[model samples]
Target: MTRREAGLTLVLMDRLRTQRLPRLQAMHARVTAGDCLDAHDLRYLCVSLEETQRMKSPSIDTREAIRAVLARLYHEITTQALSNEQARFRHAAH
Candidate 1:
């Protein structure tokens, strides 16, 4: 992605992360209750953990932060696509 694209991606990701906070809180509650997570839930939890780790890293230049955000966006897109496909297959099998 171009620098502008990466910057846009970061903005979108930030918005999405903000929007997802409630869902994350719900997931945390579920985990605290000792509930088991299904495959999709597990994947989301893993991605959230990865994102938290990335955000906690030492601060970098604007360009580097944009690059890191872009990488994270790509990772999330790929994982979401895979998860959708798996869900479709499971639904089809039922």
Candidate 2:
């Protein structure tokens, strides 16, 4: 790869390590603990999902690993969120 491409990839990886990874890990912890995601959390995830679609390029070598974690997070969060909604619906129905 050219120097510029290498530099950009490095920057992207650094951002992933420093910013995205920590936040994702935290959210994973929260969701795994049965806490519902707030509006800001949902919005952040929505934007991240959108960005991930756009970020699928050759330079970002760790994309698959990141995506795997993201998929797990999505599963946990959605499962909890759906459970919460179902409980609310049942409560209302009663």
Q: Against the true structure, whose lDDT is highest?
A: 2
What overall lDDT goes with each candidate model?
A: 0.56, 0.71
User: Which stretches in model 2 have alpha-carbon errors above 4 Å?
Assistant: 1-6, 56-62, 88-94
Candidate 1 residue pairs that clash: none
Candidate 2 structure quality by residue, lDDT tens digits, 1-94: 6677666666766776788768877887776665667889889878867655544446355768777777777777777776776776788899
* TM, every model: 0.38, 0.65
Per-residue error (Å), model 1, residue 32: 0.8
Candidate 1 C-alpha lDDT tens digits along 1-94: 5677567657655854675455655654554454444689768756765554444212357546655664565455445556666776788899
What's the lDDT of the predicted structure labeled candidate 2? 0.71
Candidate 2 TM-score versus the reference: 0.65
